[model samples]
Target: MSTSSHHRPRDLRLDFFRGLGMFIIFVAHVPENSWTLWIPARFGFSDATEIFVFCSGMASAIAFGAAFRRHGWWIGFARTAFRVWQVYWAHIALFMVTVALLLVFDRINPSVEYTERLYVIPFFEDTASAFLGLMTLTYVPNYFDILPMYLVILAMMPFVIALARISEAVALAGIGILWLFATSGYLNLPAEPWSDREWFFNPFAWQLVFFTGFAFMSGWLKPPPVNRWLIGLAIAILVVTVPFAHRWGWQNAEWIFEARDLVWGGLEKTDFGVLRYVHFLALAYVAWVAAGEGGRRLAGGGAWGRFVAITRKVGQQSLAIFLTGMVLAQVMGMVLDLIGRNMLTWALVNLSGFLILIATAYGVAWFKSQPWRKPSAAEASGSRSGAQGRAEPVSRRSELAAGE
Candidate 1:
């Protein structure tokens, strides 16, 4: 790695985006109630998942950048593998706790076949498929695990980092081709196979966004000369696409939100649809511009910071907070089902889900700060990286056991 490869440690903009992504993820999944439904698609924006995936990719770049620079590629691989394992165990623990709670409640009083669809039936159906998936670290159908894509990005980090070093232009060109395929569904790529499974995200397609974020951190895609035209172009794209999206949903095939049926023509998450991609890219651009000017100030040292600080906390402890929110949401849905809430009631109750998310994030942040475990590897790496140089710091990779 070139000393020229050496750059700043942490980028506040990336943190801002991660926090923003978490907030969007919260809103998108909260529920379709009155408080939210009326918010309008334009305001509601693209599916938040795109931003999350992109940010994760950017994080991989930053995290793996240092490791690749210091240790060899093997160390980076070992560390990434460990992080993948961490995410998997975290996911499994969440699943077990959720099933136990639901089962305990159901045992208190018998329940129906569906009973909230807590776990995927197929996960237990065949030992071969399930075992293969687990061993390969593949996604478990349509639950809330983002680990699969993150892991894939981690695996690809060396390529991305090497490309970043070789030529920023070459890396960006590769990203462009991937984006075209993801957006248009043109090519049957390595990441998004023709399998009928519903992935949380297809890493092949998502790599475009992720690598783009990496480039951003690597100074390949710095905020374009901020001008009236650039801002105008971004806004125009959103204005034109928003209503069109309403007329024809991103994936007409995904009429019922069936993950397998979704077919995206653009940057959509359903298939990495185009509108979703552009919308998120636009938002990202805006964030970048704002961060460049000043930290995208959610708040300062006063009362406002105290308030926005909650969101920042959520951003900081994203993974733990995300898993907690998923479990809580599922539990809440089960409770609502038991109460026999009508559609209207169910929607209203969804707000509680968002509240639960914020509360969980805040709570988890507080808990992690206690004197038990040391600060997360990501956090510690972040602190050290910041001491290194000027550019923004991306998320850190998990540490690996030696001799992997």
Candidate 2:
């Protein structure tokens, strides 16, 4: 195991999973003045949100588990809560920066297109309100986005982490119930009405995959010692389900759409439809198996390995890198819109945008490595104590009042 893994360092596989998720995000969200849609759909890998959110739960479990083990729940919970808040603020800053950029550009050069206008209005107007609503759990913004769910996970982290520590079965059961209810639409989450998002991710429905990942870390779901037969079975299942899903009438099931739209049927972008879930799990299995067997050779370790190494670094500082990627992707889209390209030019621009996004993430990761001064003894002790204080369970009344 890597030294970082000893400290219960972040999972490299999880980082790789998140990196893969961002690639799908680019595919789904990248502006389409031309083609590039059919291929993502044909493979049934287009909708990336479900996979991303599922992985988030798993990553949270691993990260918090390490913290919980090292320092009691109080310190562990405090650190996790603080990190979530950091991500929240980072998201807010990203939203504001994009809005500010769009507004400035609009003033300099007005346009007939609604894309930039749509983007700008969300940040300056309703999106501002939406952020506020999210903090209170009263509203969710961008039904297609993960911010709301992310915040909810943050709020519930104490209970969730505690449960994971006690019994993996209990955690799995809790997630399963949430998944069942959300997918069934049994529990209606009153998101903001104006958004009218066809449910990008009903957390209740997707929790199964997430918690299953947690099980993986807790020794509950070990990769069955990779037998050739099992590998064959997994691949066979994928081959059978994917094409069957595409051809059979099952692809467009209403039960799944009712729960969430992205993955139920065909390869739609945002909603968490059933087919999408199948495809995500299939890919995840393949990745896991490959990694288990020194497939590190396939990914490379020379210059290319160095590059993958960079991704791991960015993975280490994921919160900062993710926000940077989002902002950069949006900015790149705006630039392309301004260029007013022909078909060939548009294709090249799209490709360029994708490369730039990847490169920028690499750059941010590289930058984060610079050495910094260590905290003094007293400062470190005080910081540690503060974290412990936050971790301590508050009175039931305090928890209730905070929620209110």
Candidate 3:
């Protein structure tokens, strides 16, 4: 009943973990990068994608929920629509920019096959239809699919907010039904022009993770309590699933890997499969207990805190960070090929990408801080700005494309 509840201090936990996921995503995206062999996804049913989506959902609850509570459902829908507009354009821009980068790099060194590597050559071969699909969001290459899925999922916010009004069960039912239909393959968006292939990350199915985070953050679902037994169970689930999701330390046992599909079954990353969903919830719960709400355990005035501060900054500017990282991942892969992939070069490429991601975060923060407008004479001269002048914008984004 109160918008005030939706308004609260920034949650550092969301920012810190999201920042971690951003880095993991960069490492994973780079082709043939050995570092990817160690990322969380290699060891579990879910990976950085879950982190990105769930945190986004939590962030959206803050970003959009207040509008629904304070203004009206129509106004809330307007706000959500405006965000979808922004994300749609961001998707277009990222694809265009990336395609241009790939072409430039390929022109310099065709042997690397940069464009063909990502299947972007198809876009060039059929530029007219491809451009049409890009503009309409129908020709989503796998590398470019995440934002489109996010855009579609974000557009569903009005319905989620509306259903929450009737009852929490109704809200959950609405979410569950959508996810089920999508999982059954009855619902999906076309990702390419020539075939019936669906988007790499189907928004309807993915919305389950997105809205679960939304539900908890919006108080529609009670937060899970930390318990010793639950902790043990979560740990067991994570360890037991490693063999199924990945084949590590088992170089001679290829059959064990093949047998996994039958034993555990259907944990497809594409559909937001049931096991992926459960696995991520368990991972999130353990992280929640460890971070101790708002990530209070992560606070201090020393070097550890400094590292945490940098991570939170990255999380805060995720939209920009993600766009930059995605492009850099491709570039880094090309660079690795150019220099010859090795332990030394691999380390350098990975570290350099992280640095760039960090820089993007800080740069975005500087812009979002809006330093361009001239300061008042007193503020310009280093006097304390009045509280009203210093207050954060109420319209600040919540996370991902939902940055706050």
Candidate 4:
């Protein structure tokens, strides 16, 4: 089951897929773009949330798992805790910026409707309570909940790694129990200022998928060989499900059982239902078979290589780019609201937003690449002195996404 021998210096595939998920998220979040019709969610049971969460788990395993192995518990815990802190602040910053943007837009364009949505309405009516909730991780606005969910996951990494050290089976069983509890409504995490509501992405249930990714990447769980039959079945499910996903097909076939009815009362995104999780597993398997090596090759010439480079850069700076996209998406929504929602407006906003993301990625990549200054002789001597007593710096491949 060991995959250490199979590990690459860097998995470009992780970066490429994660960056692609970011793009999908940006497009999908745009209020009413025609382009959204073609995103993965329309064709299958899972969407970018699945991709993002799962990849993040894998990345976390690569990052924090390695630290635990090399630096022992304290250092690993510190690193994981540091990341949780980063994500916590990023979430708060995004919330404040989003609220400011909406308030300013509402003030400037008095006639334009902006804060009337269910999620936005709360902030305007009860600023004090909402602000309190935001500080407490309970007032997550729409499109702003994922980071908080991820923060919870990162906060648990030390415990997960500790349990895995005793026995991988034990760690997985614990994770499974929690997932079941969440899925069955036996466990719930409450949201403040909205006592009746819970987190949109229930970390309790979703942690199973996240831990699955982490375990697989950390060699605690080996991915089964790709099965042709399974692949065919997955493809068949996707094909059969597509018609139900579209307006034309749903309109034409009233006789067929509704897609939601086919699965035990349909898959629920918040709970990460059984069908939804299974679909993502199937999709991930097929994607692995199809792109694992091909992606590596692509990373190495030509147009595809260039594409891979850009995405890898974005993936490397995932936190910054994701936060930027969240803010930009809101701004784009305002523009569309003011100009009217036409194909031209949608195209302009989406295209401009996407380009901004790519540019941000390139900018981060350039910044990380800069050699600010060589250490002075005394500083170099101090560094060498310190190296003898500590673990080596974490490799770039093992560095988790900043906010992950």
Q: Which candidate number has the best TM-score?
A: 3
* TM-score of model number 4: 0.86
Question: Model 1 off-target regions past 4 Å?
Answer: 1-13, 30-45, 99-119, 124-139, 178-195, 198-200, 247-264, 289-292, 339-404
Write candidate 2's Cα lDDT for 123-217 as tens digits.
Answer: 34676676675455445445224665555555566776677678867766776666556655575455554564444445555555566565666
* Count of backbone collisions in candidate 3: 6
Best by lDDT: 3
- Local accuracy of candidate 3 as per-residue lDDT tens digits, 1-404: 01123332336788888999999999999989999989999898899999999989888888888788889999999999999999999999999898899988898777878888898887878899989988988899999989998989999989887888888899899999999999888999898787788899999999999998888888888776678999999988998887767765234467766666564435877788889988898898888778765556877779999998999999888888899999999899889888999999999999999998998899888888897686877776564544534543533432334752
Off by over 4 Å in 4: 247-252, 255-259, 262-266, 292-297, 374-404
In angstroms, the error of model 4 at 293 is 3.2
Model 1 residue 275 distance off true place after TM-score fit, in angstroms: 3.5
Output the worst ten-in-a-row residue range by lDDT, candidate 3: 1-10
lDDT of 1 by residue, 1-404 (tens): 00122333244445555766675555444323233343334352465566667667666666766676679777876777788778767866765575566566566546643324644444456556764665455535455446566666666766766666689787788777765765565543221122545565666677776776666655676546778888888777766555445534434535423432343444256456655667877766665555545454543678866655665666667787667666665565556556656766665566666566678777776787784577788899998877664333321222232323
Model 2 reaches what TM-score against the true structure?
0.72
Q: lDDT scores for all predictions? A: 0.59, 0.58, 0.85, 0.79
The residue pairs found clashing in candidate 4 are none
| TM-score of candidate 1 against the unseen true structure | 0.71
